[model samples]
Target: PPNGAFRGFGAPQTIFAVERHMDRLAEAIGMEPIELRKKNLLGVGSTMPTGQVLTGSVGVEECVRWALEDSDYEAKRRTLGLANKPVGGRKVRGIGASVFLHGAGFTGSGEDRLKGAVELDLLKDGHVRVRSSSTDIGQGTETVFRQIAAEGAGVPFENVSFAIPSTAHVPDSGPTVASRTVMIVGSIVGHAAKELGERVCKEQEAGGGSFAEASNRLIEREGPVVAHRRYGHPAGVKFDDATYTGTAYPAYAWACDVAEVEVDLDTFEVDLLGFWSAVDVGRAIHPVLCRGQLDGGALQSIGWALCEEVQWKDGRIVNPRMTTYIVPTALDAPPFHTHLVEEAYEHGPGGAKGIGELPMDGGAPALAAAIEHATGIVFDRIPMTPERL
Candidate 1:
């Protein structure tokens, strides 16, 4: 198998290096690490290395500030050392923070080329059927898409239905990668429903009626009213895929994570005490779902950083069984405190940017920074096991 499919995809590795270096730079300059990160943070009008200008929804500063306050970061840094002052048996506690961003949706002009699409059919019973190849892999896609379809069609949510994703039944809405299911496909679903609504209104009897009543009349007369739409980029957004210089992503989601850890000097064990995260999700379509993504992704990253590792013998399998392969369970997890910041993206559906992968980018680096603060050791490698510690 290829080295992919993990949450965060390619971001956690680079973020680990970038954030760990920030601490090193702060130490070299005798400056507070948080202050250093703040000074270098990206804001509105900042240009990414890919030459994309962040026009709006750049909420990283707010994310960092909220994470710090929620975690009592500064106060903990000042006082947690006192908690470590046992005479012979010594343990050190430390807290660390990281602020970062994940590009939402496909890179550059990928969405434009893909032209993801959706179809809506108005049935004779005043119900709408969404026809799209967007699969719900437990990220609440069906719920969110149904909400979008209902709002666009001017019907009750219960009146909207989603066809199971099958090639013979649904249009190609592109693959469910790049965190674009809700942001891209849901937007198309909304537009298609709206178009279907307009068509129904135009074909129905002239007398005014509820959307359902109008849809019922139109579908009865016309057999079934159908409308389709494809995604298009917001106007004036330009990208040259050949040059690889343009809007890298239609929008970005920002986040900051703070990790609190206690390291035992004698045993060389690191225990996560607590974790705090603040995310700027553009807007959360569902608050509970958003928090679940953050908490789950954070735990996954923590496992990667602290314990999950694979051993190889002669380039073959070793410890492949679940019993031997270590992974973090509920007992290993710390209390997760998560905050959501809404900075709307004009192009997003209901002002939502991609969120599923954003939490994965911050946790490992934050945990590594916490370990460094606790032990004065720079851990560049992950899975910072007892032997490595």
Candidate 2:
């Protein structure tokens, strides 16, 4: 089967391996797993294998610490036992956590080559419109762009509008993927809006009139007032695409997830009791929307960790429908508690980093770790069905 891109790209699968290894290492050394994790966390000065030195906004440690504290992880671990133990006749409890990072925007030279661009159209009524081929796809792309445009234009948020992205009407700002809508494209939108705002202010100074009146005059005289901007890598940031090295992404969002689970020995069913997540998303432009992203993405991760799977038979898919291929509904989701850690990235719009996919990278490994804590059985494969258990 041909592999295509999905949420988190391949980050979740890689994170599961790394996090599970952390647990095994802790057990081998007879140290607290959380302590071991904290001791090895990357900080601002740490360098990646790609030759990129993390110069700022390295918040993995904070994410881990806050996730632990907010989840009362130590207390839960003590109650659940550091090592596997029988809690009762039919059930056992366990707590596990995973900390990881997700890079914002495209990888390596993706942004460099694409050069996502945005154009701000100054409407005749002193309003501004964002023109870019970046679709919203229900992730609040337009809403966010509007907020950024308004701020950049020094106008009311209501005065800024977003065109329904069309290639004919807007510049090709690249596809709406890699969680780049708000980070990369948004930054471009801000730049264009700022330029437009500067023109309006300049007109106001020369014509001796109100800001809105100057904007109207400029639009009437110049016909169409527009400001265009394009995305560029931060100064000195470089990547070698051929060798797959150096500054893979402009910025990275950090996250930690702690999951508590109860295993029913009689039925071999794993039930998640609670889940807590802490993410360092640079800055959240909209707190509610940010939380919504985390909640939704974490739920998807939880589904992937437990029940979501496709069945194959011979050379064809067996369960291709939702009914046969099971998934978690609202009733099945565990209580979720999400927290945001804001360590502003200097170049991002409102210091915001990508939040859309970060939540998808941690839950699976965290759930697996919890199950390991409960049963003392290290199941290598996912979907940990009763038959496998």
Candidate 3:
């Protein structure tokens, strides 16, 4: 399949492979996979391949501990051992868990180098509009941006409007990928709004009038009260482009996915029963929206793990249309519970971090782990179709 930015970007696919390996390793060594993972887990103060220290809000350990408790993992694992009994003929159950850390923004020095910018304008209609080139591709980009802008500017959310994404009207807040829209770009928007708010208040104080009156006065006199900001690294942030060193991400989003699977022995049909995701996205600007991201990513990851396959006819994708291609629907998606753990990124807007693809990082791994447990099979590749089984 041609690669593009999906919900978890590259994470779901990558972790699908890693987590499968984790389960295989655990079985080989005769230990519970969770115990093995816990021993090797990296938490706060751990260093990365780039040698950057995880200094704040690291929550992977909490995610593992909580997911295990919430899922009744140990007891469930014991019951799966009963699959050999005849009461559950021709079917086997497996529970698997996976954990991963996803960088919230660009890989390294990306924000510093990109120098993304944003603008907030006090409109003539007593409303505010934010101008940034972050497009909404069904990932709640516009809604989340508006939320941050409204809260940061201290204005009513209804008073804020989302502008169509265009370079002519909006500034370059960089691309909408790499899960950067909320943390890196939204932070820029928040900073710009904060600056705009301060300017408006300063005017109100000097002119001895209400906020609206002062805002109008400032606009009329100044030709438009516009606040603009270019991205600047929060103090002490630095990276080396030449060496691939230094902070890979300004903040990391951590998650753990626990999956339960039931396999049909006769048909090799893999059915996902339940999935739970625990994530520390710093904080959620909109809890409902955060859950939406988590569910959507998990469902897609499930498809990627067990069902999706793109046949090629010559150079074209055979499944070019949804009519021919297979994708998961509401009926196919399992019941997924999302647990948000807030440690709060100090640099993020309203203390909320980016989770655009964070949920994507762990699902495949967990699913593959569960599949392995059920079938006693260690398949190396995905799209674990019936034929492959």
Superposed Cα deviation of residue 81, candidate 1 (Å)? 4.4
User: Residue 82 lDDT in model 2?
Assistant: 32
Off by over 4 Å in 1: 1-3, 81-84, 203-205
lDDT of each: 0.86, 0.88, 0.82
Q: What's the distance in Å from true for residue 163, model 1?
A: 1.2
* Predicted structure with the largest lDDT when compared to the true one: 2
For model 2, residues 268-297, the per-residue Cα lDDT tens digits are 898899999999989989888888889889
What is the TM-score of candidate 3? 0.94
Residue 88, model 1, lDDT: 75
In the range 198-279, model 1's lDDT, one tens digit per residue, is 7767655585686667777776677757888899888877789888998888889999999999998889899899999999
In candidate 3, position 217 carries an lDDT of 82
Q: Evaluate residue 250 in candidate 2 and report its C-alpha lDDT on the 0 to 100 scale.
A: 89
Number of the top TM-score candidate? 2
What TM-scores do the predictions have?
Answer: 0.95, 0.96, 0.94
Give the Å error, residue 39, model 3: 1.7
What residue pairs are clashing in model 3?
A: none
Order of the predicted models by lDDT, top scorer first: 2, 1, 3
